[model samples]
Target: MSVVEVREDGPVSIISINRPDRRNAINQQVALDLQSAFAAFDASGQRVAVLTGAGEDAFSAGADFTDLPELWRCIPTVGITTDKPIIAAVTGWCIGGALVAVMACDLCVASESAKFSYPEARLGFTGGMIAGLAARIPHKVAMEVMLLGATLDARRAYEVGLVNRVVANGRQVEEAVAMARELAESAPLVLGTIKRFVTESIMPKGPSELMGRATRELGAVRESEDGREGMRAAREKRKPVYKGR
Candidate 1:
């Protein structure tokens, strides 16, 4: 069986880590499968996606140690980006590379049972390319998570803005799916445009360049029919039905 399972639920595509026996530890195959699943979701033009682990015990314990060298060799393949919005449903024990995976998503919804850590120090390694965490969390908190190798509970993560929401145990995926469904109901072009704008403007780049890109890209979405539909729906007090146009 595949270590990762991709399932589509209407406009929300779910990518699940299925190796519960290893606490959903990522291996080379899992990385490839995850990349494939995200690519598929992007190609399908899905408005949103949910990434979660198969079992309740762990979202992921990080990369399979046995496959460390292989994983290191395939790091580029493991990091895939998509235009669609992704929501991470963190259940438990999110650590090391698993933490990076969750951070890569647009939003995160975690269970109360969830615990996040960067144990690279303990393992004689360092967290790699964690741009999102630095952007999302306060500097002090980010430093602590990195330096102490201590686990932060879901509530603490939410407080630090690392997690958007925290639900009861076993409810993470359901809540994340609901959130994804809500996002999917919006104008796709507008959503995608706004995501790009914010990501460029606020994260990882200078404001001037991001502003230019935002201004150039915003016009396309603004001129779309879905934009009009959004306005009309607002006036009508009904949900907008966007055809991704």
Candidate 2:
């Protein structure tokens, strides 16, 4: 069976880590499949993607210990970038590379039963992407999570802004799909433009440069047919139909 399964759910594509027998751990095949799935989703013109694990017991227990070296190399270098947003639907436990995957996503919706940690230190392994940890959580919290190597519950994750929403166990995927569907129904170009703007705003650039880029992007959007439709739809009190212009 495939280590990862990709399925279409309307405008949202679901990419599931399917190695539940191993707690959905990341291995060589899993990494390749996931990379392929993401690429396919981007090329398929899907509006959004929901990434999850197959079983209720874990989102991913991290890298398969037996293939740690391969995973270490593959995790960082391989993965596709998609213009469409990706939502991580985390359930059960997340650790190591699993946490990395979720952090890479645009949004994260986690189940209340979910737990997170990076125990690499305890195992004499170095952590991946220290800068990412610092960027995602408060300084002290990020330090504590990494240095202490303690698992945190989903509620704590939400409080730290690492997770967007936390729902009851088994509801993470459902909640994420609902959010994705809402996004998919909206103007795709607007969403892509906003994502680009946010990304540019965070880059190391002067205010003038950032503002210039934002102004140009906005001007382009404002001149598009979708922009006119958005206004017309507001006037008509109905949803806008955007053709991705």
Candidate 3:
């Protein structure tokens, strides 16, 4: 079965991460499928895209630990500035690299049960969350999130401008689709132009540069002593004894 599912809803395209059994954690295959889904949405006539996870448990739990090193390398974490608008329909635990995916979207509509976090510090990896989330939330909030591995519930996330909407539990996808449909009513060219202008104004580096930076930073993390320890601990179902190396 496909790890990611892409469906058309009139002018809106819905792309869902379909690994509910794994709390939607992204592995290499899932990463490739997700990229393909977004590529199709961008190339198609779909005016808006809504990204979600299959189950109510999680939008994504982060990268699967079985092959932690390959997760970041294969996952599409940086330089995705799509001309067409994309919305995130988040619920449950959206943690670690999952924060990057959510923040990358133009808009996020989360359910009451949704919780956002960056726990990569514990995993011996620096989540590229700062660059992705800082522009969307306050500097202090962003710092705390990455440094302290802080978690924010749906209401708190909305209050801090991390997400656009907080709907009742189980309504995340519905609300996001509704919002996308509303956006679809506007002229496509105008919407694309506005998105491009806003993106250009905010992004500090070009997509290519950002991608290169992400790869280098993550590569360093993968080679760290703590990185191997973290992965081993995860596979062993125990706490990592981080030596801060």
Per-candidate alpha-carbon RMSD to the true structure: 12.9, 13.2, 12.0
Q: Write the per-residue lDDT of candidate 2 for residues 1-245, one digit (tens) a residue.
A: 99899888899998899999999998888876787777678788789999999999999998887865334222211234556788999999998878866765789999999998888788887545433666667878877878888787999999999999999999999999999999999999888887666544552333433343454467569979999999999999999999989
Instruction: Return the lDDT, model 2, position 128.
Output: 51
Model 1 global lDDT (CA atoms, 0 to 1):
0.78
What TM-score, over all chains together, does every model reach?
0.78, 0.78, 0.80
lDDT, candidates in the order shown:
0.78, 0.78, 0.80
Which parts of model 2 have CA positions greater than 4 angstroms off? 69-78, 200-245
RMSD of 3: 12.0
- Tens-digit lDDT string for candidate 3 (48-85): 99989998999998888874523333233343436888
How far residue 196's Cα lies from its native spot in candidate 2, in Å, is 3.0
Model 3, runs deviating above 4 Å: 69-81, 127-129, 206-209, 212-245
| Deviation (Å) of 213 in candidate 1 | 19
Q: What TM-score number comes out for model 3?
A: 0.80
